[model samples]
Target: MLLSLPNWIIHLSSALEWGIAAALLFHYGKITGRRDIRLFGLAMLPHWSGSFFVLGYHISGDTIPILLDMSELINLFGSTALLLATLNLLKSTKKTSATSYTAALAAIMIAGKPQSYLGADIFDAILQLSSVVYITFLVLLLKVWRRDRTIFSGLTVAGFWFVLIFISVTIFCMYLATVVRGYPTLSHDDLLHGLAESLLSISNLMIAIGAHRKIREYKREQLNAIQG
Candidate 1:
């Protein structure tokens, strides 16, 4: 039953995820060449890498331990990267307070490490906070669009997709938590987890596409300015 799924399906999904990540990295590099975004993108690479690792583990079964270890590392990296990316984006908008917010969230996540048995609570809190932040961020994007419709058109599209994905993940996470607490016997947490992961992958892909478009637009603007 191993590798029962079509090989093409697996490769196609992997290719799409990595391709999106690469596009985001290229755009981030071109924008400001900032080390933070580059590092963020690098941190994201492992998640996609671990996906393939897990797929291989599924097929072989012998490498389950290695795949689990890799997955843990990837999760940690992604957690940190999400905080860093949000901070960087906020900083780009000249929001100095966002750094402090990011630091607080990072501290909470660090404190909630599994060794302390408080990681779950911390992670849950982080998710809740992220949901609020995402909503606020979307509102800000809407306000920006209203004020200067053309200035951030590409970003607006990107933000829309990002918010959609964020909302979907948040809802699924909430449902999963509820199911775990309320129906421990018939728990469908694993399915929920898979759904969340898939949604996140999709979200990343969408953001990468948005970033690519924004990068192209920025380059066009630069060229026009130069020629004018």
Candidate 2:
């Protein structure tokens, strides 16, 4: 019963956190008037939309593969959307390189087989490697905020690092349990995936905080200009 509680919460909150993230990013985009941010917000919806199918998949058992495949598709789409959003924020030739790499990885993930288990699969590997893109996005955002001397830069950076840690630990646990231990069960991967889902809530919360920080900074800048 104890072990089941967090799993239930994580499963349910996966959709909730994603919905909240969408709302926050949409609000942030509107406030900042950034098209890229708005697109990112739009991308968030499909990420968690698979939760419905996941719940059904569990209830109906593994007889159906479509639901599982849907989840993988959603994951690929969300990541691709994030990559596009990140590239949109930049005005450099590097954007093309980033686009190529991100598109290639996303294509690979999309073309991968559905992995319902913790075993080695192209899908799982692509998902793990996609973390590099996420980390890069956060780092670039942090640099932008740093240059602007935004009050939220430090907190944003902290949040980014926390996400990195969470993903790394989750991946390590997955490998240790599945590959090293030679266990056939998905016990470890399931637990870590749940934990990662919860961490996503924290990550989105950080974004909301950054949105508020942006507002505060804008006000300060306006006041200083008026005073001058």
User: What is the C-alpha lDDT profile of model 1 across 1-228, one tens digit per residue?
Assistant: 133234425334644765575557645555856665565456556556655655655556334546545655554555455445545555555535665765665566466563544345554444444444444445444544454333334543464456477556757676655764563321234444445445545655565666666567778988999999
TM-score of each: 0.56, 0.61
Over 116-181, each residue of candidate 2 has an lDDT whose tens digit, in order, gives 323366555445544545555565556444544432336544654676766666667677768877
- Measure candidate 1: CA RMSD: 6.9
lDDT of 2: 0.59
Per model, state how many residue pairs clash: 0, 0
Which residue pairs clash within candidate 2?
none
In TM-score terms, candidate 1 sits at 0.56
- TM-score leader: 2
Model 2 TM-score? 0.61
